[model samples]
Target: MSYLPDRVPLHGPKFAADPHAAYAELRRMGPVGRVELSPGAPAYLVTDYRAALDLLHDTDTWSKDTRPWQQNQPADSPLVPMLGWRPNALFNDGKAHERYRSVITDSYALIEPHQLRRQVSKVANQLIGEFAAAGEADLIGQYARRLPLLLFHAQFGADDQEGPRLEADMAGMLDSQPDKAIQANINFANYITELIRSKRLQRGQDLTSWFMDHPAALTPDELADQIVLTMLAGNEPTANLIGNALSRMLSNPAYYSSLSSGALTAHDAINDVLRNEPPMANYSAHVPRHAVHFHGTWIRPHELVLVSYHAANTEPGPTADEKTAGGDDGAHLAWAAGPHSCPVKKPATLIATVAIEQLTRRLHDLELGVPRNELRWRPGGFHRALAQLPARFTPIAPDPDGVSPWTSSSPYSSTRQDKTWSPKPPACATSGPLYG
Candidate 1:
């Protein structure tokens, strides 16, 4: 009898092209699997939610600064020279990363809850209103893409002219073309270095100025480095969350009606969307400590380990269902695990919640103007999102005095599935109160 071929399934570009299905298959393969990494670094894949969570935050065991798959370029040398390069906090580990987080926390999380909520609500409504009026628009390129950039611009006090250029540069950085990311990274770094210097000369009352004041604690160069990382790390996730969440609303016709019927809160919908498809499919670190006992394999040090955030979010358990219980599954490792999990978790969540709620309450029907299958999604970025999401919808008309309650009755059918954002308020300029 001829020997049978191994039935093992292979996942890589073939599966990464559309990772959800592959994730399901990987989930079935126990909590862990092995895969070859760039430069042939031996690596283990963590698909199990439980194990992945422990593996991520066990800082003692796993580290963010694991040895590079190939070799570590001198810290003085440029790590990303293509678009631009800035070390920021992600490039290091231990106390250094901690200090970086503290600075961001004060601005993002230290604000009083009342003020944060008010500001988020205001920004959400103002942005949604402009897009709602347009009747149809691309959610990713128009609203989802613009909102975070504006917020960051205001937060950092970067020039209004910078948003469009920065977004374009970010897109280029994600290109699959050889050396594109590197080129984009380098260019971006150089630009940020100069921007930081200018901000220092005439300090303004914004996040950038805050950094200028804290150079003793974080140095001007380090802050310049952080400027790039913070922008990249935050914007991409927001875009995906918006696009991915909108995808859910379109898929589940009942979702809009449920929300319009006052059965679900905006927060509830966001939780579901994140669980369904977070912006990032996965997060990787070089296993800085080197050789780790992965699945009983001695695997020598310097091996790469890939943690599947997408799988971890979908982990089947009550823990992941905290959305129902009114708590974010602290168990979901999408932000990574432990105290070191995504530093801006609180603010990112707030912004996402506010944007979704504002839009959900103001619109009636949301129909995709373009074929869903034809939509393009960008890959190879730190996060994943649509290159564009073409859509159309009708906004609820505002009341006589203008401000309508978030739960106002829409003349349009409760079941709309459109993705849009514009600079004008929606036909309906109603008050979009917070829900769930």
Candidate 2:
């Protein structure tokens, strides 16, 4: 609590641009540091990991409600409006939270991890094959953006063409006001509406079908909300992770080739990627309820405070002086910790694993089509993603030249045999694909 200097800096672009700098200073200052949320609102940063863990885990102390502070402040408080939705269990705590979140968390048990492995590898292969022939292409726009859509599509048994439009709408809501978020809500609602309706007619193994059968437990609209929320939370972060991971790995030939040649395991690749470039630099936690107090300062019931997931991962741990690449077991706060941690992180991890593993397995000596420094990353927020990740590669010898080509359209079929990708022989180069 005393970490806050007598004078605290106001939260604005500086804090958003790089909160770590301020956090680093705050950490040095000690436990709780003071900072301003707006012109009049005084807030404290819970910098110490022990204390932070307390806040993120204890629903009794903090309330997720925005009401207390919102009501106290003037109606036009810009701070009230700027803080966005935390729809998942991330914002809730205690009994009410456990009840709602349990529905989704229990659903995770039904996600066939083994089944997903083969399916996701196929998805990875399909996308990577597109760039494999050309030698390279933007990993983010071309694949990262598409892979999650593909996963969500298969997971819920959705139609092939729905992802792009839905993802775009979700992106729009992330920026628009809550009132305006309704449009996206409606768009997503309509889609899920139709999806569930059809499933009712002829149910499949997809979770949506499960919900359809359990209509006694969840109404069609509630089921649709669950699906919509899952999509919003799962889609972008996973896409950004894939983008961040691929761009980081593909940037260095030594690292890229190691995986391609099977020198390093996909497990190693995913671990290292997360350490170097986590999707979120920082993720915020809203107070679960009132009475959560850190130090002498009150996080005060429903108030919103941004926990530095970025800072927590990089900060010195109890035994180690710095962060370590411990994989899913890593103390890395990227997936968060305790009650608010992402339950689907395993599935998310496997999703990334499949993509990286299969893609690297397929491609040979990669040539950097775009300079590493030339790549653009999402700069202002937690999700640091490359706008594009382009690369080039030389095909294997003998009949090498015009190599394997990918199908023009992205596949929706989860079955691999039905979705065969031609690994065409590498082309004979006038300049050669790799040379180009």
Candidate 3:
């Protein structure tokens, strides 16, 4: 008999360093490989492209609900915060999923493409202006990470001051430390609770208000749950997308030049990243409703199954001509598939592409401060995020008119003046725990 490890570990620095290698090893086991997200948190990771699609599209056989799987997990398992059952669409099925997803999709639809592009450009300029004069900046920390948070805050009509807190809370939740992740979960819930209460009292032209006014008429608790899902789901992955795209462009001169000369668009770079180094590499968690054979593997009932977007996208299968004839755009499962695919795909793409375009345009000569090989990837099973993207460029000074040189000629030049809405304090404090 062929020898196989008990379970391949998806976490830790070793896997983060080169996950593709790990995925290759997992392939020896079959299309679906047994993997541990963390100690004692095992699942079946779909590494084959066809197998991943099979699982993603077969919602009737494989459920999005995680409660049944969570019941078998230790209470202190760090995965709970991320994969735990919630009232949102991510953990629901059928009508409940449709209802929750509609609110998000409808609210996002309210943000026109032009408006979203303008918003991304405005925030990109603001963030770039902070580091433009410094000659060097950690693009991931100063730009990629903050841009999405600020945009989400604007979308939700949240206080700018709360941005850092939300970012920290998100970091905690994604951290491997169980205590920190649990605590961050509590803090994030409180933050959403306060946001909903505030929006209920004073409505604004924002997603929170739109969610509240949506025909679904979600209850306060439901609203809180949905917001938690939306903000975290949108923020982290979008940030990683920006970071990954920028890293790829900066490390590859020909690619960067093509981007600058308009020979290749930001969309091209973004798409390339989506295909190879997707931000959320190993997610789209699903549970098999009952024991069944899947792609030649016998899966247990309620077994945790995760789709490895990175592995599946890069899995060696398609020929070059076949890929070309079929078109490579829709083949990747980065935004996932079927009932649980990403709802904000358009907005997320717009945000990342615009963010990269604005940054590269402003810092035309931006290059990696350290060797590309030296750049560190954040250790996690779910996300393919860079710890930092340090970059250097010729410093640009503010114009005599006190406007950022980067923003003065922007397409959305009047964005600063046009943005007038500010956040309002909550009408009342949220008391007690967000969940029982």
For candidate 3, what's the RMSD? Answer: 5.9
Ranking by TM-score: 3, 1, 2
Residue 45, model 2, lDDT? 56
> lDDT tens string, model 2, 1-436?
5444553454455554455676678677566666565567655556665565666666566555555555666766655533433343444456645644555655544555666676677566556655555655666767778788777776677776776666666555554376666576677667777788777777666656654444235655556656776776677778877766666676655466565664556676566656545676554546545454565565556455656555555666564233333323455567766665776788788888777666665564545577776765544434555656776655422112222233323232122333422222222112211101
The estimated TM-scores of all candidates read: 0.75, 0.74, 0.90
43: Cα error in model 1, Å? 3.7
Highest lDDT, which number? 3
Range of the 10 consecutive residues with the lowest summed lDDT in candidate 2: 427-436
Task: Give per-residue lDDT, candidate 2, residue 365.
Answer: 54
- The per-candidate count of clashes, in order, stands at 39, 28, 0
Instruction: Show where candidate 3 strays beyond 4 Å.
Output: 175-180, 320-329, 399-417, 420-436
Tell me the whole-model lDDT of each prediction, alpha carbons only. 0.59, 0.59, 0.81
Q: Pick the winner on TM-score between candidates 1 and 2.
A: 1
Candidate 3 C-alpha lDDT tens digits along 193-285:
888878878888788888888788898888888887898888889999999999988888666554466566678888889988988999988
Per-residue lDDT of model 1, residues 215-296, tens digit only: 2367766777667667877887876787777766655556655544556665666677666566766655536365666554
